[model samples]
Target chain A: MERGGRFHTKSAELLAQVTWEVAGLPDPEEERKRQAAEFAALAAQYHPHPPLARNLIFAFLVGGSICAIGQLFIALFQSLGMTDVQASARASITLLALGSLLTGLGVYDEIGRVGGAGAAIPITGFANSIVSPAMEYRTEGLVFGFAARLFSIAGPVVTFGILAAMASALIRFLVTG
Target chain B: MVTGNAIAIRQASKRLGHQTMRFETAPAVVASASVVGLREGQGPLGRYFETILEDERYGERCWEQAESRILKEAVNTALGLAGWKEDELDALISGDLLNQISASNFASRNTQMPFLGIFSACATIAEGLLLAATLLEAGVAARVIAAASSHHEAAERQFRYPNEFGAQRPMTAQWTATAAGAIALGLPADGGGGAGWGAAADGSTGEAQLLPRITFATVGKVVEMGQKDPYDMGTAEVPAAWDTLLAHFRETGRDPAYYDLILTGDLARIGSEIFREGMRRRGLDVSSRHMDCGVLLYRPEQDVHAGGSGAGCAASVLASYILKEMRKGRFRRVLFVGTGSLHNPVSIQQGEPIPTIAHAVAIEA
Candidate 1:
């Protein structure tokens, strides 16, 4: 708030003026006129919905694309008469491996390059990080190799989830046993 | 014809407050005694550096960190060359590139002088000089030190990443190299040399740090070329530099014929040409004095695809070459402009062209 005798509104206006004075530029009125014109033209080309729309479409596309690959894995396992849970587990594993492969090859980043936010927000994105680096680190040694790292990221996630599941199991047992 | 005296050389600093934590400072002091955290990762050793360039290429980050660590060094170096103490001086005026200005805040933590913060992105160092000059001439304080800084790790984490799980980045998104920088200004009576940091001893009220007087800094005409990528900041930086250059010439009542050097912060190679051509179209001839910070760091052999950005690139170079030239009195006058593009992915994807800004300070040695 401004001190007494100087209105807050006027002080703000003055502060705006001071900014111009310091920059050695013209007064606010001139700049305002110039900005108004620039903004009017910009409004025509860019739409608020395009990027968001493009992204929504992309998420469905990539998510669908990955899901389709997962479906193929499921079909392969099911045709061989695997259990439903078995097929689902096998599909996730296949994707985890695939994600790791793209990540290692640095190809998934290419997809991200084209889609911007489109490829970014999906479960497959996480798969890429864990798998890619692990695969890249393969040359380091097998005791610490690619197959070993298949669980590097998944390792932590599973560990935490299992611990959480155990705690949840204990709580349920205490309440309903 | 000489306008001022002391020259600023070498700047470094650190940030202490706010990491994901919300901190508070007086509105006036907010700009001073501040370090910006793009994320908690920017300071000494953070994860962002590990993934981006690896340890072998940490030289740029080290120079950057040194640049951040040495704003006080540059000021003190100039002061050492000048020979002055804290109380013998007046106040410290400075700024930084953080959300809350942690760089200057952390920097001021070590010094005994008062802090006045500022924000003009890469232009703050020169802007700091201009402010220090104004105060010296205004008799606000007999001597004052001004400074500014930036960091990459912190900036990237805050602006780009909330989580690293597997975010794909764009090429236009130049990695904000991790580092810090600082500079000190003074207007002392005696020319007796040797002060903290290094001193530009020969400059009196008529030397680079003291006298030339910051008559004005041109407010740039920001142009949004509608480049949507948060990665391609050059689009905005080039125009800002070009616009600022034109504004500098027009405001000072001269053409490009007036300056021997016109330097822009962090515009790199692609930006340099765009800025030069952009200015040429305006009928402003810049045969000389048109250089970019991106051009100076590393050689073509280093293979930095797009070149460099980040507050340190310009601040460190300014501390080394430009400030050295100022101290030698090689340039009677120079126009240093720092260009920055205000951008975020949210805004870009919302289809907004990045709004850009540049600040210009004319110096005489």
Candidate 2:
């Protein structure tokens, strides 16, 4: 398959110190550049053009709506006489529960489909990732199916999150000291 | 007793039109059954399917196992409807979307018949039908069954991402159909001589003659047009579909107007448009008769972005809607082009271009 390359023969082995070199040396860098350009042209035709403006509007609206709902919950909690921190915590919990519930009921999937990253960038979307897998694997059983798959997507996030929190707390303590 | 089979068995003739095969004896689809999950059962052609599970699980351990179980049920239903016992089948050709086609293997294992495991990715149903017809044409098999299946969650987990990953699917991404379909092919029972099997043996004779027959098939070549995006599969597969359709027309000396309908399997909306445009460029306008199984499988409001896709997407739709409509005299001649993206997750990860193939089967009433 190597075109123009010299082939080694039985008779050539006896011709010691007389090397039969290839006709032309192939340049790796040059070949790579050519291939890259070819791929780029093909991709330009094959790859779908992103609708940046429309997507931006969708993301802004959906993300803004989710945050607005969260703020509403916070305001309601505060009106009920809870402290600011407690109200904020309660509002986040409510949003997470609603996200998981909607996901389990198959509504969040539709929302995520059209909302795109707008729906996915919020705290509820995180809850969706955790709940969606669990709901899908529910047929496997409660412990093995649901519980096992529940963390398949969120486990790494939790792992790094705790580690980062610990490091940040240590730095804060050292700086204060 | 002689089984009312055909009087003369022709020799194994090769090369029909171009890459097409003309069976000496067209194999008749005696019985067929389509089984789908809850989501698919709610689609437009839901009532046409033989079995619709209220629950997606169907009493299995996982989505994969559920897929296998439904496939087995579909095959069993087809056999039962044909009034043929398990031992009557000479061979079972089957496939699924799972690795090694385990769902089909599992389904076939239950029958204990001679099984052929085929994998054309999503085009497996068409591939199986062509091979089954070839067996009948060669006079090697009296009765044969071909089936294929897929589960949405199972296919997603294996091909793209885990359902729980909360991965945002692009608009171009398609939904994998959770369904199974089985078709039975056999010699004409009412042939002049009592040389073949018929209704007296199984009590399904009344419905035998109405079944659509497999008349021809064209095997497609693998075409790679340097497409790499896994999400946008339509652009990758449309070229292969167009190539095969052109080949079928060229080899058969026919035009797009020859068929009542020309359907492509699981191209969805995006691929369907590309296929139509490609055909138009080739001087064959098929927009009037052209339809896609992917786009037909779901409602727009269902939020299936590109449309439905999978081995089951074509298999179930053909077995239920197309065959039933043909039986009702809605279509006289139809061409089904089954398109498959023969790429694995590893291939996509390695940045290899997706290679695609499409097989066409001509079914006539």
Per-candidate TM-score against the hidden true structure = 0.56, 0.77
Q: Summarize candidate 1's per-residue lDDT along A1-177 as a digit string, tens digits.
A: 446656877789899899999999999687765754563344323212334566567767776777788889999999999998999898888877776566666677667644444455445666765655455444446667556665654566678989999999999999999
Best by TM-score: 2
Q: So what's the TM-score on candidate 2?
A: 0.77
Model 1 lDDT, full chain set: 0.54
Per-residue C-alpha lDDT of model 1 across residues B263-359, encoded as one tens digit per residue: 7877666556666765766788674767766566444443344555666556555554555545546654667787777765567658887777776
Worst 10 residues of 2 chain B by lDDT: B192-201
Two-chain DockQ for model 1: 0.10
A-chain TM-score, model 1: 0.51
Candidate 2, what DockQ?
A: 0.23
| CAPRI accuracy category, model 2 | incorrect
Where does candidate 1 stray beyond 4 Å? A1-124, A127-177, B1-82, B86-89, B162-171, B188-216, B219-228, B300-304, B328-332, B343-353
